[model samples]
Target: MFRTVVMIFFACVAGVATAEDTRLKRLDTGDDSRGWEAVGRLDIGGKGFCTGALIAPDLVLTAAHCLYDSLSGAQINHEEIEFLAGWRNGRASAYRWVRRAVVHPEYVYNGKVSADRVRNDVALLELHHPIRNTTVVPFATDQRPKKGDRIGVVSYARERSEAPSMQEACRVMARQSGMLIMSCEADFGSSGAPVFSFQDGVPRIVSVVSAKAEVAGHKVSLGTQLEGPLAVLKAALAQGQGAFSAAPAPRENRITVGTRNSSSGAKFIKN
Candidate 1:
């Protein structure tokens, strides 16, 4: 009976992706979403987009504004950017690519300020050469997992001054609203991190880390649901020839949460 139970336990664990009981640092209590990748720098030779996992190889999901011209509402600017998988120093070399970028048609920056910021702060770039590296964790398509749901997040962000020299946080956090906002402190460079939920044993992205803000003097982050963009990106990824493509129209864009902007403070419903 013990052996049978052990086997069943292993089966259940296998059906669910592994997650750590990641400790909470100086946090006000929130979910931990781990879906992050390092693409290129964030300036001229620097910035383009911060990458995160999407289901398969060749496709990378990120912010829409990363690819557009902030001023013109034109098209993608950067030609080639490096995609680093697992993004460790010596283990794997970064993948270089001329990209294929797509932004949702509904993505529009506020015309008053910059066109691109409103253009849609999300995008999917298909690599010039398919990456034969790293596991491409799939996304949760359209379903939004509930609060207190354990989620995993991974990212290769700005390495600050420390022995680890890197600011990397894994483990999971409680979810808030329809959005999964974590108190994980990410910098400007970590913008497009993928937020994954280890549900039914597979790692699936439920949302993409979209913004960070100060709420009541505490740091908090937010991600729009993955379903909207993932649907469009999947269809575009299958195509491979366009600069950009999106799913059918009437797509509900991802939600926006912050201190005083769209959403009020966040709350989780115990399930």
Candidate 2:
């Protein structure tokens, strides 16, 4: 599915050969995960999960597809979602329930792998309460990086779902139709992971993981550029598009790695 999508785009544009990829380092200990407390795991409907990051004390940035059910093509109830900030080894720096969620208006979840779907596959999640922990500072976002630029990714995935892993260096292989093809390692449970660009030694978000794909037998991750879509999501939130009814009290035992279901919404590209 992804191969066909990427191949179509690659035929029209040239992509740089991937540079030496960086190995993922697990952040299992506090010392290793400090300053990265904003990246968390999103548990959805007790059926699966995805990666997410806090952009504001109350807003989380993730892929739009993460808010839907892959099997039914239906939006999951916001109350069924929870954000476990800086989740690692059965604990989290902060826990919050999703009070509201807003997907990009242009994004359509038709269960297809297309540039249009991946381009607008971004979402903003509003937490019921802000995370005011001093250690879990929210991350700021920057404009999208260019092709061949060095970037990083911190995400929770299949085998390492209990902890987040950082791939300190990866290259943007190509940019086409508002989508990015990156050499970062991503897999099931890695959707909505924040793609970071370190400028002057400070990390800022530039893209959101939409799906994982293969190009010429090489594994690559798909991402959405944040400049326009983020603004749209914020505007929708301000206009009360994300508002929801009263939510139930938060729970303590909702942290788990996302398991693959019928559609693998946010994680995999379907044919």
Candidate 3:
């Protein structure tokens, strides 16, 4: 199913290819991860994890599918989620429990792969308390990158879950149906990883990893465009939709509660 999707995307866009992509560098040391403190790990229910970034002191940006149970297709309790900001070598710069979460209204976790799924695969998380550490700052979002634009990804995956890895040079291979196909390295647990565009030497998030895929034997990552779906997610949060809390009684103050893949032999998998 994912192979078909990748093939279709390749056919739709001409000259879809990666150029001089760099190898992944493990950010195992403090100095190696200095400016990327905002990119952190989302530990969910002690079952699995995903990558996420602080877009605001109290808000996190990640893929919508990260909020659901892959087996039950049910939304996970927000209280079970924790954000480990700048986690490395068994310690974190700051730790906070999730207070609320909002998935994109158009995203549906039906356990199927499709363009619609990838296009709307975004979510926003609100922390119980804002991260106020001077070293851990939130990143700003930017418009989606164009095809062939250079980008970078910082993420934690299955075998490398202890720390994040940085892929500093990758290209946007194509843009289709509001999704980006890029040469960035992604794997299981990399879902919700931020795709960064360095403008004026300042890194800004432009997309969020939705899945991992292989097209004609080359590995690629899938992501959602931030500009439109992100606006929708923020609006949903403002409108008080899909909010969850662990409190015994719902608080009158309506602020929080919260809460890919591959292509195969030419296939697709949610990271």
Candidate 2: give the clashing pairs. 49-258
Output the number of the lDDT-best candidate: 2
Misplaced by over 4 Å in model 3 are: 1-9, 12-21, 245-271
Q: 1 or 2: which has the higher TM-score?
A: 2
Using Cα atoms with residue i matched to residue i, what is each candidate's TM-score against the true structure? 0.60, 0.86, 0.86
Model 1 whole-model lDDT (C-alpha atoms)? 0.45
Candidate 2, 70: how far from true, in Å? Answer: 0.9
Q: What lDDT tens digits, residue by residue, belong to model 3 across residues 123-224?
A: 999899999998998999999999888899999888888899999799888787678888886888899999999988889999999887666567778888
Give the lowest summed-lDDT range of ten residues in model 1: 1-10
* Model 2 C-alpha lDDT per residue in residues 1-271, reported as the tens digit of each score: 1112332224422344565757899999999999999999999879889999999999999988887766666677878899999999999999999999988877877666666678888999999999999999999999989987899999998888999999978988777768888888788888999999998989999999887876656667889979999999999999989864343322223112134321212223344
**lDDT of candidate 2 at residue 7, scale 0 to 100:** 27
Model 3 has an lDDT value of: 0.79
lDDT of 2 at 260: 33
- Provide the lDDT at 67 for model 3: 82
Candidate 2: where is the Cα deviation over 4 Å?
Answer: 1-9, 12-16, 244-271
CA lDDT scores, all candidates in order: 0.45, 0.81, 0.79
